[model samples]
Target: MSAVTEGRPRSPWAAPPRPAWEGEPSKAGLAGKGLVLGIACLAVLFPLWIVIVTSLSSKKTITEAGGLVLIPKGITFIAYQELLSGGQVTRATIISILVTLVGTLFSMTVSVLCAYGLSRTSSLGHRWFLMTLLATMFFGAGLIPTYLLVQTLGLTDTYLALILPSAVSVFNILVLRGFFMGISPELIDSARIDGAGDWRILWKIVLPLSRAVVAVITLFYAVGYWSAWFNASIYLSDQDMMPLQNVMIQLVQKQEAPMGMGQAIKTGQLSELAVQMAVMVLALLPVAFLSPFVQKHFKKGMLTGAVKG
Candidate 1:
């Protein structure tokens, strides 16, 4: 028995030491990771820094300095003052705000209703209707046809040209439909048993629970409407009916004219660059302010709509 015990295999503690390379930290690897991360952060931050500096710089300084500013030496608000003062630009800004607000409300309401209706599996022709809606995303009616249709509807030179034609967005509808589908089936059944009709269920149950998705889609619609100019230029012939973007384009053109056209032209050429920057800043403020408010919900909303289905 003693001989058998001695012949048995020894424990792993009896093994030889491993090579030093096995456990040592790699300085090169750590340095590479740090370098990549630093570069990525700089790439993202540089554009934002430049925009802020340009927006705050004086017109004369910006013109003299061939490149972007790292630090603004002299800050001024003269550009902002010129933009807000009475002109076609101010009128257009008012028009744009109104359109954005009204269009967002209208688009969201219609999208919610359409999406909710289509989300139900038992709804008639649901698949076919959904496919038809999606088809419009890839292929649009030609511009001429769309223009003719608008003309036939007597919507030219009117706000309805902007509001009614774009009342529903196919992409937004799909996002909302996916969100509605993600709601628990059991909750819907319970609502039914409690004598809740479709409208009541949508209002009391669906909408309340869908705040994140609704807010995200509302932001999308608002930004789109605020930035829209092509439709306005095409359908609205009246200068008074122009939106801010169109007016800004006209202002830029005048600024680009030769130096000796007239007194007004000379003044425009002198102030054009500053005025352009100011208009851009004004147009961007609403989006900048509103984005952070909805940004918290944006990722969750997009994921709920996209990956869920």
Candidate 2:
């Protein structure tokens, strides 16, 4: 190389070479890291793959495979067909969907209103309300007391039992209240000057600017409601009213399927494992499809709501 070329000054915009301490990694290190990651991925995905395969396998294949199927052969969706054809499973799935949608909407509305009211320091009993919510976070009514309260209100064996008792989350309220408090007071003042009522200001001004946190909170509540089973098991005595998650628990933990699928099981057309796996897949699909749409907001929302501005 020419001396001038070698001696040329570095451009100001050029990125500096990595320091020797952070120099290129050894092939061994790269290989080891890749190996570790690959193993971890396989470890996590292997069981999921097995579940899918087992659910898709024929009764004979499952029987031959002994238990969980690692390799899929003679794939059949009869398991899914059996589960879906059974009216009970279908009804349970519908119930779960309804609960998730209605519960999330109700919870979000209450949380938002409570948070907004609590955010205003000038509101009456603001400190007391805040303390109460925080106390609930630290302490909860025992299961017996809570059940009695639900029973006293005549919510047992009803859909209201699944929703009303756990409608508001103290943690969610605190997070949202903190977020609302972070909004510039000038914005509220400007809205007030424009003759915007508190309702209008909250709806038009606050919510639009708080979409990220709202999406995160909505997902949180939706996921919680979707996965909830203990509440249903406690409050609902009617088999027809039990949600998918509760039914799933019955199937997986107790190896029980509703009467609709029991005939197929009795006839040796479906295995208990296949039915359980099918139920898992059915429950997973909705959340899996829904997550990607809201994932973009998740990280930003959590971080922004968590950190004071």
Candidate 3:
């Protein structure tokens, strides 16, 4: 036996002492937490399960149930087939994907450059610019003014209106700026001494190290662009140009009772509860899949890069 293992008397294997801050959790407390988490998971997942099952359920089963189907009597892809058969839904999906991709790219580029520039305390008028940006977060120019501005700029009925009006999120800028500021100045100074410029250092060093925060912000921008219907509803006059969310609102938000799922599957009917659930699933699936992969960094990024000022 090693000297560390040698003792006056042999003892049974046991766990080492926990730190005071991490005292052993009581079994009841652990059980309670587990129970709470389990219930929470079920609360979130049960509705999602019902939506999926309802969407996949046979038209006869749905008609008989007259509500969300928890246990699908029979599975059918008719809902999906109807939704995607060269219809408005298909076009809207493509439009939404394009908007999300292009908007996220544009937003991230502008926000990153703006955050980097403003993070430099030495930059002239940065404080004023930052204050101006922050001020807009609390107080917005009313809808009329914003609409008139877009109109004056000839962005009405254009995709640019959906993208440009709210492209640079002030909150994301602040988060990124805080993260940039948190970086050690010594690294930047050393890079400068090695013949690197501000842009070079920012691209090569700062950005590479700030992946977690940047990814979280990018996901935020993507989700915002994907889910945004108000902008399209206000700016876009042509139904062809409207994003998926706007199309969904147009289809699902009417006060009239939805048509039957069987009618929905056959005659391009879209107002049924099953159809609505299918649309919801389609809209939610992208973000739902994307979030869990990056969720490990989400909390850390939010806490570490949260703007103190």
**What is each predicted model's overall lDDT from 0 to 1?**
0.81, 0.88, 0.85
lDDT, candidate 2, 1-309, per-residue tens: 688877999898999889975988899889998999999999988988988999898888889999888898888888888778757888999999999999999999999999999988988999998898888888988999999999999999999898998888888887888788889999999999989998998999889988988998998999989988889998988999999998888899888886588888889988888888989998888888889989999777877777853
Worst 10 residues of 3 by lDDT: 255-264
Tens digits of per-residue lDDT for model 3 on 140-242?
A: 9899999999999999999999899989989899999999998898999999999999889989998998898999999999999999999998888997798
Q: Give the runs in model 2 whose Cα sits over 4 Å from its true position.
A: 1-36
Q: Tell me each candidate's RMSD, in Å, in order.
A: 7.1, 4.6, 6.1
Q: Pick the candidate with the highest lDDT.
A: 2
Q: Over the stretch 1-309, how does candidate 1's per-residue lDDT look in tens digits?
A: 989977997778787666876656599977987999999999987876776677667756777776455678888776555556666667788999999999999999899999999989888999999999999999999899999999999999999898887778999999999999999989999999999999999999999998999999999999999988889989999988989887767656655321222244356433455566566767878998999999999998988987665
TM-score of 1: 0.80
Candidate 1 deviant stretches above 4 angstroms: 1-52, 66-70, 253-270
Per-prediction TM-score:
0.80, 0.88, 0.88
Candidate 1 Cα lDDT to native: 0.81
Worst 10 residues of 2 by lDDT: 300-309
- Output the TM-score of candidate 2: 0.88
